[model samples]
Target: MTQTPDETASDAGSQLLDAALMHVPFDGWSDTAFRAAIEDTGIAPAVARGLFPRGAIDLAAAFHRRGDDAMVTALQQHDLSTMRFRDQVTLAVRLRLEAVEDKEAVRRGATLFALPMHAAEGARLVWGTADRIWTALGDTSRDINWYTKRATLSGVYSSTVLYWLGDDSLEHQATWAFLDRRIGDVMQIEKTKAQLRKAPGLSSVLKRADSLLSRVKAPKSKHSNLPGGWTVPR
Candidate 1:
């Protein structure tokens, strides 16, 4: 059977990316590496540009997404039935970083996204990864908690990736230790929030707040093209 146009394009993009990976460490995710990959793959120039309009930037984005896909697949196979919620989340972040085949590729992509113009895109990718992890863990949040969960995990995942990249300890033990500390900090914040919610003076105030926030639903998967989804109280 003939491949659909989108499928064909995806195949070409994967080919280009696989070839590009060989050159990425040497040249970073730059135009030179992209061009060399095109040559290596023998994919036409127009087709390559059509597939990656922003050239190497798009390639870097694709790479990050590929890692996210791998992490999700790994999460599906894990036996998380016995772990605490915190350990489950920590394992998710750990698997994400472990999915990377080359730390230097991430280092290069990080530098690229650090530029003012690309920072937003970089952030979006990080949030996307965090979103995938939460979804894989069977998160059922539908209100403001949806956004908050992803936002909080994004921070933890991003910091852990940075630490992991620089870590030289055996099997990156130090990075895992650092990740545990960050997760502990987030858990403490959550504990405080739980206490505040139950406090006599704050209970009524927070209940009112939660009523308003409940109107802010999770973006439906079909309508996710929008940044967010919500319903205003009449």
Candidate 2:
């Protein structure tokens, strides 16, 4: 398939973002990473800034898009149609996060997005991810349900990302457990909505769809919270 101009641009941006990761923890998502990556890759500042106007946040967003792209590619190996909708969503979330090898990258990404001015941008990024996941899972929502589905999954994906950051349990066991719970909560809400389709209870369940998930603390395995070498807890 011939790639479009936008696809070409996106690939170039991802290459720059990958180079920037080495500097993310040190120089952060801002100028240092940007300059170093551009210098190394010879990407013009005008073009780089054009793609990532908000500096590090734009790089962070690119990193996030990379993850989403990876997740979609990985899902191609599985027949999502064979899985339950909830399971498909669960796998999508896991595969997306699995692309991040450096914990600090996520830590930095979270910090970049947590700024008050960027809150809406952060939400939009999550929504885009949810939309992609749903579309990849063969969702047919074309109405208000589209908004509601994305909104609900955003809660799940964002919360799971938070949990994953601190996960010290072997292979992110704690994080996956937290994700399962969140997915289950969504599943329950969906069930409730179906049952209440003809009643007035859907409003309440929809409201609850964005429920507050409790923070998941890292597991206290013998391995300890080593900063650089984060091994999957045995």
Say which candidate scores most in TM-score: 1
Clashing pairs in 1: none
Residue by residue across 88-108, what tens digits does model 2's lDDT show? 888989998987777898888
lDDT of 1 by residue, 104-158 (tens): 9999999989999999999999999999999999999888899999999999998
Badly placed stretches (over 4 Å) of model 2 are: 1-12, 197-234
Off by over 4 Å in 1: 1-4
* Residue 192, model 2, lDDT: 81
lDDT of 1: 0.94
Model 2 weakest 10-residue run by lDDT: 210-219
TM-score of 1: 0.95
The worst-scoring run of ten residues by lDDT in candidate 1 lies at: 221-230
